[model samples]
Target: MSTPGQPKDPAAYAGPLSGRRAQAARNDHAILSAARTVFLQNPHAPVAAVATAAGVGISALYRRYPGKEQLLQKLCADGLRTFIAVAERHSDAQPDPFTALKEFVRGIVDADVHALTVKLAGTFTPTPELGELSARAGTLAQEIFNRAFEAGALRADADANDIPMVFEQLTAIRLRDEARTAALRHRYLDVLMDGLRSSQGAEALSAPPPSSQELGERWIAPDAIMD
Candidate 1:
């Protein structure tokens, strides 16, 4: 193997991709990012909306995704994987518990993952792979929550179930510019962290935090809902 920072063979993988391949990769990234933003803003939007937002031709998009369900599946899978990767990385970097928790929160916000749930949830049945990923993601997130609480970094009244709802609330804040909205959301996240931390003057929550099952029940498809 090569040194820690060096590629095993730079010539094989580090140089520019072929013109067509490089362009394809860029287009794919643009399409998926645009799809996430567009669909989250309006779940009922047409596939052509994604193409327009991505600045690519409709044919190009159809060639890659074939249909809106496929695109939604890919976007949600990407967001889930992003969450898993962030959690795994931070889990290994165990320093100050609350600081790690805050970093984890920031990483998720940067991913802007909760938007997928806020709008596109239940739009398509999840694939088996997506189901597996969701299971792993939940485990990692709860581990992070447990670590903070066990270390007394997090407040007793703040349960792990509060995490998703807080992130979802952030997703509801829309602005004309993405960067501006992110900045505002992050500013408020700092305020949230202060409240979450265990403090002498912390007040008890008015009600119990949502249970994990209840938080999860929100994603159940309309067909699966019961009286």
Candidate 2:
């Protein structure tokens, strides 16, 4: 028998607790994977679809996510974190700062394309947490840009803030089919990279472009028009 003042054997209790934690981790991973797959195929896919894809019951999914918005918030946060990590890794690994910047830009675009809901949700209603993630990613991007400029790989007139504008332009490319969309995105990315090069034989831009804050404010979702 255990003493009244002493605890039970830690190993005896650890088995059940560890099993529960492992199951919870598996459920979380499955739910997130299912949500990402569904969202990639159709950003407007219902929560039921995610549950079905995850092989979990609706109740189980709800128990973990509470609601669709909460699930989306988690997905967005994960995607943003991944994007920041990729940018940091590329920036640190590449010897050529310009190549690093290009890879960073490509990484962001790839993530944005895959996480369509996350990208669109930001335009309509961004949570403070989401904004914070974006700001952190932007900081890494600015560092890459500064390094490229110092290395004479990027044009002196290029603005770090223009990175978003470049992404916005890339996102505007639409096609009737996904295949064409992917192809065009790559082609345009190459064009954008060329324009960013220091060797571009053109006069320096006369004025600065709009700030990132201004761009964000201007992109508020349109409300219904009254007759």
Candidate 3:
């Protein structure tokens, strides 16, 4: 027997409680968007400032992002998601494994030139979270290279270990002051891919002759003169 003044059963409110949780998620996403804008404007912005920008209370900001590092991690993860989606789409388009790999490299280069990764890096130091994100990206990249090598798109004897090094160098060229040489970089990307292609009766192809190292040696001149 319920007293006249008694409240209804709390169990009757489960559906509304679930809806509130979903609404909280949406609000958190909005806060993240605001934080992202704030970070882009000032990578070192204080949490209070970001909360102000997001139009949320400081307590709410803390609820969603406990610290600067967590915010940075979320930003890096968001950027990686964009890149991974692009790579996966490109990978799906190629009919052959070798072509797919080449296209994948091209997509990465394109991303380097046009994606927000460089901009994000310019705004803030890469945190450990960013390093983890890069490691995950490396897994996809390695798979692409392996598929290319297995399909005879790369040199028959290309060292698997060296492939990652080459990729890091190539993709990183976009940050070079000399990346103004887009034509040159494209040429280099192609030349690097050619060297990786298997030479089993594959006629030796000539690429634009390699040039001197640039950007203080982070960018290697493509080896365009291999047989």
Candidate 4:
């Protein structure tokens, strides 16, 4: 007889175990890729849509993710982690703080994670991992902004919080049109980057902009206008 935790048929168990692990990994990759695509097209898309796109059964998807909410949470978590890593990489690689910030924004826009996350922002409560990632990203962004300011690369009035609002505005560009999306993002980002610079040509603001908290509230509720 086999031990309690051991398989009775070792050969059979080994064959299936290895195959199942490989198959599960493939399924996970497929599901995540499909989720990113489908959610990019429609953030409120159903789990059935994701399963269909993934070429997997609904049961298979549910086995990995209990529901659409769980899948969305996972997607957001993964995107946030990737975004943070990209930011860190750019920050470390570029000696000029302004160049680093520009590269970071370019990377994020190219990744299209910001648009997806913005679409799903209020749909689910953030998991601990997601929350932590967001907080860390925020801190990193602040550090980058500070460095840019000290280097005289950014306007004295600019705030780190303004970056997300710029991202939110950029997300309005139709991402489904890949060529147009790329062109528009680069064009607008150039304008935004120029506006952030401490050049004498920069226009002075008439009044103070909204706070980060105000931006958050307004972003989550598009219908609410901020004065």
Q: What's each prediction's TM-score? A: 0.84, 0.68, 0.47, 0.81
lDDT of 2 by residue, 77-186 (tens): 67667767777778877888888888877777655533354344533355799889878977887889899989999788888877777877876676779678867888
- As for lDDT, the candidate ahead, 2 or 3, is 2
Per-residue alpha-carbon lDDT of candidate 1 for residues 1-227, written as tens digits (9 for 90 to 100): 32211112323445788888877776777787678768877887999998999899999999899898898888778778888988888874868888888888877877777767557776777889988999999899899889999999988888888888778776667799978998988988888888889998877989988887776676678889989
Return the lDDT, model 4, position 220. 49
Per-residue lDDT for 10-100 in model 4, tens only? 3433445567776776677778878877887887789999999989999999999999889988888877877787778777688988988
C-alpha root-mean-square deviation, each candidate: 5.4, 10.1, 14.1, 9.0
User: For residues 43-95, could you state the per-residue lDDT of candidate 3 as single tens digits?
Assistant: 66787887787677888778877887677667666767555665667655877
Off by over 4 Å in 2: 1-21, 109-118, 122-125, 165-188, 203-210, 218-227
- Pull out the clashing pairs in model 3: 153-197, 154-196, 154-197, 154-198, 155-196, 155-197
Best by lDDT: 1
- Candidate achieving the largest TM-score: 1
| lDDT-better candidate, 1 vs 4 | 1
Question: Which sequence of candidate numbers ranks them by lDDT, best first?
Answer: 1, 4, 2, 3
For each candidate, what is the lDDT? 0.79, 0.72, 0.58, 0.76
The residue pairs found clashing in candidate 2 are none
- Ordered from best to worst TM-score, the candidate numbers read 1, 4, 2, 3
Q: Which stretches of candidate 1 lie over 4 Å from their true place?
A: 1-16, 177-179
Total residue pair clashes for candidate 2: 0
